[model samples]
Target chain A: GSSRPMKQTKESPNVGDVMSRDVVTVFEDIPVEKAAKLIISGSFDHLPVVSRDGRLIGIITAWDISKAVASGKPSRIAEIMTRRVHSVRLDEPIELAARTLDTHSISALPVVDREHKVIGMITSNHLSRLLARRR
Target chain B: GSSRPMKQTKESPNVGDVMSRDVVTVFEDIPVEKAAKLIISGSFDHLPVVSRDGRLIGIITAWDISKAVASGKPSRIAEIMTRRVHSVRLDEPIELAARTLDTHSISALPVVDREHKVIGMITSNHLSRLLARRR
Candidate 1:
């Protein structure tokens, strides 16, 4: 006897299931130059900023880093980090994240919880994994 | 002004010229699961594995993370991360790096120095920047 498929009213993958729950983060207090260095050395497109206790704050990206580098100085990361963050809930539909990335031409989204604390992140590359494995 | 017309000499764009001199990295000591979380949360395609002294050891990717998760505890990240790292020096021609990425179907390459320490990284996205800006 094989017990397998479970019936469900609707089917969808959620951010909690596929989203990367652990995110690379930078302290909001980190120097702008350090943040830029992380983006360059890590090859990460973007990074989330958080409080000491892991509360979500904002995000910084390579473009922002580049700007800081080009500006040369007198620019702090706090001033340049994106405050208008676009986030999704753990239970939100993956499609929501995809749409967010597509609409903004953003490559990633910070995943947050009820307290607005970032839990993970979702990127087009992660979404591509879903496509690569789905039969 | 003919001042810009300069003497004729062979010219080339080297990897160091455009490579992100900054790199995001993980210590080889980090937990494998934590590494996976980093991949997902950071929205990074690949992350360089470094030693305590910042020597380039290997690299882990989203796929590596997934496999580690799938294999469960019996697996160690050191075993899964790509050990046969294909690296390019900072001074290597960009063409060489591009060819390596294309040939291996890898998305990024760790830029190293003569000592084999990761100095930076080059990715398709960075290369895209050149095309996007060049007339």
Candidate 2:
């Protein structure tokens, strides 16, 4: 009755190893239209919002930006960005990152450093890719 | 300084307590265009794909439908629906449901009953609302 494949017991991976390092970030003051263009053209659902010194501040998701555009409202990225961003650290377990994404119902998380500087991004798509590889 | 308000110590909530009972599902054989319209009109990013008997089967995200439409491919909902659906039972803890959504990187989960029938939907937006209430 054991039809399912045995779960792998290999060494657990960390967030740093699985995170995407070619990170794309947006400034807090950019026009919402510009951010929308970046997301549509790049096929990304979320972008980390950063400060002038590159510290992580907020995140903008497709839903927020698209709704604003669809509503034909003029706005700035800061107006639409979610300020209570949930993030993961470089040295944490990927499992924790996954839990964070789940608990918040968010698809991507900004990976931060000791000073809460943006380092990388880990998305549900990335986690899906990792699982696909394992299977 | 204890600036952060005392974390609410109330009894934890369950999936059934927060789920949207009026679920919107699409048949497996429908045209992808129809699905797109439903999403666009409703402002929903995901829909539960069900069998003719209303059995929970798969899921289709706006991303999948939009990409197929954008690529000018003639496709059916069945062709675009993800077959490996992750669902939660009605009686399961909301925390477990949150974890499932997180682990899978999905925004909503189709809540099922003992017979594996589609019952309700719990989404990240709902969770965010719940958290907002707590705060």
Candidate 3:
């Protein structure tokens, strides 16, 4: 008699399982200086820029702040923030998130909902931790 | 009769295997502005600060530059760089690198030699790529 194949015990986690739920976001109207302070104080390198209705608009990073300092322009987040943001949904596979990050050369991605509101954030730091645990 | 156990086909790679060998370093005496330019022009967020004799002295990140811009002080790299930098050895395991990065809340570590000179650099980006491949 043939035996059934063993059920797989380990399944790949989704982005929601690894992402940080309590994301710190900044409004587009805020000064870049304030956003810089938030990034400096927090452990995160990127922050999602939100609209008045709490929708994801853009993303700001330490690099943007450095650029502002270097060029002495764009005092507001709306000016220096990267308008073309890449994001992932909660139910997406971790591999997809990893691929997106690697392809875009970005460190983090904001997790958005159906309404395009930022719900969480994931970064390479999270992937590093996951790899450490697996090892 | 007894049988020997099967040998493991896969082993964890070392820091040397994944690290970027061509590291970009900056001198300690250069202006923070110069370092900021290098960071902007390059794809790296951190730059190792080297002595005149090519010894690793400190490390500077985009966060440091943001701090300088926010505070409007410390124009030179020596003043703004983090003196207490954590590094890794080439022959060490990748898990150790991950743990060091996680423990210290740093994104990258400079790989050093027996003489404490920078030889390579590794970051979370590399680890992310590794994880992606394993999946």
Number of the predicted model whose DockQ against the real structure is largest: 3
Ranking by TM-score: 3, 2, 1
Order the candidates by DockQ, highest first.
3, 2, 1
Candidate 2, which CAPRI tier?
incorrect
Error (Å) of candidate 3 at residue B50 is 1.0
What are the per-residue Cα lDDT tens digits for candidate 3 across A1-135?
A: 113211111466889999999999999989877887888888578999999898999999988887786676587889999999999999998888888888988889999999999999999888887756654
Pitting candidate 2 against candidate 3, the one with the higher DockQ is: 3
lDDT of each: 0.65, 0.71, 0.84
lDDT of 1 by residue, B1-135 (tens): 223321211244778997887678887767665665565455455789988888888897754543332333323467777878899998787667766765675657999888788899877555434322321
Candidates ranked by lDDT: 3, 2, 1
The residue-level lDDT of candidate 3 at B7 comes to 20
Best-fitting candidate, scored by lDDT: 3
Model no. 1, DockQ = 0.02
The 10 consecutive residues of candidate 2 chain B with the worst lDDT sum are B1-10
lDDT per residue for candidate 3 within B1-135, as digits (tens), equals 013211211366889999999899999888877888888888678999988877889999988887776676587899989999999999998889988888888899999999999999989988877766653
TM-score of each: 0.47, 0.55, 0.91
Candidate by candidate, in order, the iRMS in Å equals 16.7, 9.9, 4.9
Where does model 3 sit among the CAPRI classes?
A: acceptable
Candidate 2 lDDT by residue in tens digits, A1-135: 133233322345789988988788999888776776666566667789999888999998666643443344456888768899999998887777777776776778999998888999987666544433432
True contacts kept of 2: 0.02
Better of 2 and 3 by lDDT: 3
